[model samples]
Target: FMPASLLATGSERIVSGLFLGTALSISSVKIVAMVVREMNFMRRDLGQIIVSSAIIEDTIGWVIIAITIGIATHGRIELASLAFTLAGVAAFMAFSFTLGRRIVFDAIRWTNDTFRSEYAVVTVILAIMGGMALVTDLIGVHTVLGAFVAGILVGESPILSRHIEGQLRGVITALFMPVFFGVAGLSADLTVLVDPELALLTVALVAIASLGKFGGAFIGAEVAGMSRSEGIAVGCGMNARGSTEVIVASIGLSIGVISHTLFTMIVTMAVITTLAMPPTLRWALGRLPMGEAEKKRLEREEVDQRGFITNLERLLVVVDEGVVGRFAAYLAGVIGAGKPTTVLRTSGESEADPVEAAHLDEIEKGAEQGREAAKEADEEPAHEAPLTRRTHDAPLSAEAVAKEARKGYGMLLIGLGRAVTAKGGFSRRLNEVAGAFEGPLCLVLKPAGVGRQMPRLGPGSGRILVPVNGTANARRGAELALAVASVTGAPVKVLYVARPGRDEPRDTVSHRRREAVLKDIVALADRYGVEIETAIRSRAAAADAIARQAGRNVALIVMGVARRPGEELIFGETTSGVLQRCPCPVMLISDARLRRDDEGREALRSGTGTG
Candidate 1:
């Protein structure tokens, strides 16, 4: 304000300067995110801090802009009116973040589940944004603040998958955003800059914006205990005004607080600063050194990028009202605590089977437990809303499940009381359901005599046993085990199950292979921030070793097995042995392969593999 006052003298000087200064004070969050992503610094400490600071600045900057507009609206700021406006703004923000967020989440979930039309959720999101914007406008503030709050609320919903986010971003980038910037750009005329006085003023504006933002950010970074290199990168990063300046300047112009000349100057400063940010920030960040802790964190994050459990976008649970179903729900809740999980309750063989309220209650209770566990672990539930959706549209059948499978599920979980037969093989009903979904699946089977003794598998319940053979399937199972342990705080025991004849000689090569496999599992545990105990047992059948290690205290045994081509759901001799002999509940995660019919297998063997 003092800098702009050098050129102005009248009553309008103070208000104009306030508007222009506020416009220049904010940084562009979108631009910062793009640059960070481009530089692959999004997961780094410095990158996170820079992005978080920009977000906070943008939020607070919008509120200040609203208040300034409120003062301008009243012609001359009266203390009573100003106080009332400030109170209203605070109340609105508090309500939006607290109760209003819940309302928005519920609305989005309902729209997503109830509608069969495409883009129904997106439609409801826009309506919610418009409604909130109208409320803010009624409260004498700008509509953008309300829209911003609504976007945050919608983004927090658990069901807002990356696909939906891309849809929204696509429409904005393709249509609305281009028009917005085009109009803003066309309004600025370079002809007015030919005047020497205005040209000099524009230069002065750029200098002031750069120096003030850089110095303030550097000082603030140092005060927060950041190193000198980090402070320099932050200052350089925050200097870009970009879209934010255009928005504030446009608002000021529309409200008659700033003239066209001042608006053009602000836009020009925005352009120059934004153009200069990338190179400067890159140079500044290049000088910073990575600590040992940061390097380890980056390695873990890289593992997460290629992990199976971490990349599951959605989960489907097929269950019944029996104990097995309830147990499956509990495990599903833990595995999918951070993803959207849909529960499809089997109403029995007859179409007239009633949907049991008890089953629905179990699903909710299990999901609640999972949410609590996630919160206790300080794990970020990317999508915290829309925990579970229950469906009972059709009776249990191949056709019914096949229909649901078309909706794109990453993984399926099946748990029914009769899923296993007396011969310890998968029952016909279980095979039917499993064949309907072609993706990866986990089958929760109840051991003989488990009956009503199976307790809720939650935090501190018991130990988890994972058998590893150093195969891709084994690693996948280990990853799932680690995820579950991370959420439930269960102690994990990774047992290296060596084949009886293959690992006979404990030579150097064998020892090195075993060590490498165990080390890989340990690294996976670190990715999920879980500690585990390792055990190596050889010169025994893989199934026998696994069953012996799964003692009474072991609550669950999770194994990853590959599906063999056959008319039924077959998982080789080893998996069958573990399923028949292990006392605890077993979770079998199978590879992405469906059972091939007899004709298909015969054709391949006879050298006539055509369809």
Candidate 2:
């Protein structure tokens, strides 16, 4: 009984519905694609759930569209037609799932076997997606369902899936997805829900939908016997509607089941849920100390299974003819037992062998005299006997040392000794090596008269001194000290020096701040189960304070250094000053040790010692 104009208008509406449904479906996919990449959800449990739910939402949207078409044709939805359409969809989905999986897997295998080009594999994946979409459209189901099904089919195809995902990610995440969400927001009319009753209704709908999702997921997790915190995490994760909600709202609008007002309200709900997810997830996860077993399992499955080594901690051993250097090299080899080991021998034409030999001869003569004097008299000499002269094929050179150490070590261990007196002379050369070397360095001093059989570094050996200024380089030095302490089981002495006139007066804030800083270092030492003694010294110069303290029973000093611009100084000012004055051997950690972004460290941790 409707007019001819009304019939024509109805026909136009149907056509519009088709276009709107297709566009929104794509837009919804864009939302998901964007969020996934931005949040790096590929490795997250919530991401998996979102992907699965997206599939359901897409499938349901298609079913609703088909029912809407039936309603438009018959002035009401025909139950038989609806049943037939659903049956066809179900059958098609099953066939596609089975056959499509095989097709996708075979294509991946072919790509791997043929050209072995990632680009080609990506092209093939896109072809399959497009083909599947066409077939689904021809069969009267929505294209979104086809895309969802295609994604599922390709999911198991490792080669094609990875390739396609990599290619699609940039385009989808950077441009398409954000634009689509922005457009959806622009299209929304917030004024429609201004009525108090409509606003209440919207709130009620949001509450119901959120509860349905959260409760359903929570129940599933509980039934699976998950921990209370884990169950809550799952529930909070599932409550994020986002892209799926957008797709559902779009479908409702297209089918005339929901008006623009309702669509806007639903969109708002989706945005709220999406925005709430990150904070809620963080809270839930923070509440539960993620079990070690669960973390290990996840790490194994998501990270270790990839077989890509990322984090590696290396130990570099630099050796010379001296007993201290040799011992350090041996200790490094022991530390890097299962990891990579690089043995750096400094030997080159640039290094004069005769000069070093003469110095060693002088030291040996001193040792002989000291020994004779000891045997003859009861009074001890003020200074200890020095080391002997030895010659070998390898000469100490920085480049050679670095090249050898780079083989498999993360931490660089260098011997500390004086070129002449066997105390402060070799520290500058060691610092130069630390600066030129690519990783962290640990310097070990061999005391005068200590034989080839090095004493085991332990609590009885002596106290290890760590000078900290809270710099990243200092932290690295601390890490090296900790590693040494772990090996020797030695107690650590942490010293914080406050330069009297640098900024704050020594009597006021600077002294108190220094105390607080030492407290923090002590706390950290405690965490590692090491004995820590903290001190605050007031001096005009950091080096002076540290040197004066070094004279007081500290066997070793660990200090941080950086390359001075346009200068060939082995150590930074503070470290150099300390080395020049301190009687003990000093370890200088370089800027390279503090570079947190170095992929080398990650590679080392993952058991690759390339750095």
Candidate 3:
């Protein structure tokens, strides 16, 4: 028998060990929480895995804690009590699996309809989770099991689950989780490994734990037919114990299963594993061709969703040395600089001619002159005085100039040729710039030598012309045009064409339909707080009617390019026809460019406007 003094000393040591174990457990959890919070697991695959592992570890730790508590209270471990506890846990899980699905689905649907707010739904979900946790804790299973089970149930309700996940993700993953880990690190005492044997044992245990997880995952991957490199990646990834291991260590310490020294060692192991994963993953990924399949899948997905892709906020501007073209290009550049600007060469007159050859001589000459002008402008500090000092009037017919600007240009810019020359062949380019191009046209003219300076329009410079037909593209075009109008404080003219067929006459129904469209335009105009004009014309060709109306005074004409199934016109024939006949600069707006709300707004706002 032991002496009373010796027994008392042994009891004191055991009590001290229990206290140290509990402290270590708490410390481990804190460390894990810190790492996970800092790492932002929600955005990464590793984070997800770490979170999952942590959940499992937490559950196991809680079970051990409960058992330790029972042992301490009873003064001995009872086999029957353990058996009963195990049976109760299994029974509770079975019930949850069966009834939890229905409850979760119904609850989510009800919450969605009643609350109408995502936050409300999240609140309901948390309530259910908390309730489930309470039930599990009362049943002596573990609150963590209940939390996990609740997560699984909620996960089944994809929509609600996604909403709650999104709402909670930042708070839980970014803030609280990291703080917990940092707190754990602060609580850890690294001096416990002063004994050489204890230090070696701790290291061995960490190695064994890491190898067990890594080996299991790698072997599983290999058995599932992964390549050697892929299996290795899986192993390396799984070896990262991280937050989960720390949580497990904490739980063990709380339950009196692990010593303070052992817990510190485990925490160290977790940190090393977490730090090593990134480089190991990079190396493993470099050695594997696993990304090929993923790349192909993403490419296919993009193709499948091509119709949904919106146009970028970019404007394609055509430029040349001609006065009108240069002014238009400069204006476009200024407005679209915040966007994207594409310059195309349109000097070559013939459609059949090779573009490179036709523009080669002109391009080279322009490049040389541009370089010289840039150098002179750079040397002259007061270059802003006036370009007219050295500017020689390059004589060209307005028609020729407009035609050159039309090639590949989304909008045409030209100075209004003298009205006296309007009927004359000399003002052909001005006519085209004003009416012929199927896009927005800017006609700028300065009296002979006074160069046209871009005037700033107040509030209303984004005047746009949107011709709607109720089609998706037409609606998009209208919205885009409106956005532009809003930005520039420009008025919108929504022209809905009602063409009378050669056989059919314009009737009451057509008139009513036209009236409805006008009303819509007016309503939208009012909503956006801009000027709106609606026109319905009886004509043979819808494109011609629309163009004629649009050409009247608008800064830009926005029209949809119709695309049809099989034997489809590559370029909208109607748009091309309008481009050929319209008097104003035409914007051959395609569905491709006006997909996004922002892009649509930018495109519509991108032109010279007279506010």
Candidate 1 lDDT by residue in tens digits, 1-611: 33453332233665666667788889999888888878888889999999999999999999888888887777667899789888889999999989998888778766765677778878888899999999888888888888888888888776676777888888878997899899888778878789888889889999999999999999999999999999999999999988988988888877778777777888999999999999999899888888898898789889988898878877888987677777787778777765777778875423223446555566566556667755676655544434455566555888877777765578999987756665568888888998898789899887664554555555678788999989989999999888878766788889998757645455678778989999999989987878999988887888888878876588989888998866689898888888778778888898886437787679878978643
Candidate 3 segments whose C-alpha is farther than 4 A from its true place: 1-78, 116-118, 161-163, 290-295, 302-611
Native-referenced Cα lDDT, model 3: 0.49
Which lDDT tens digits does candidate 2 get at residues 1-611?
11232122334445434433432332144444455546555445555555565556556656565445544444444677667667767777788877767677667545544564546666676688888877666665556567667777776553332335678676667986788678667767989677787787767756766677677767887898877777777666556656766765665555554457757877877877777766775676557554575454455444323211112233445556555554455445333433333344444223223234432332334334434433443324323311112233554556655444433334566664443233333445654666555555556654333334444456787677888876656766665565456445667877776556545555876567666666655554543346777776655578788877877776667766554433243445676467567766555655534323458568778877543
- Please give the range of 10 consecutive residues that has the lowest summed lDDT in model 3: 381-390
Q: Give candidate 2 misplaced runs (Cα > 4 Å).
A: 1-213, 220-233, 241-317, 320-322, 326-423, 427-435, 438-442, 445-455, 468-476, 498-507, 539-555, 572-585, 592-611
- At residue 388, what lDDT does model 1 achieve? 57
Local error of candidate 3 at 582, Å? 25
Instruction: Give the clash count for each candidate.
Output: 0, 29, 31
Residue 16 in model 3: lDDT = 35
* Candidate 1's TM-score: 0.83
Output the TM-score of candidate 3.
0.43
Q: Each prediction's Cα lDDT score?
A: 0.80, 0.56, 0.49
Instruction: Sort the candidates on TM-score, descending order.
Output: 1, 2, 3
Task: Estimate TM-scores for all models.
Answer: 0.83, 0.44, 0.43
lDDT of 2: 0.56
Per-residue lDDT of candidate 3, residues 389-506 (tens digit): 0111333343543443332234333333231122212234333333333443333332232223333322444345677765656655565455345434566778776565543334
Error of 2 at 82 (Å): 31
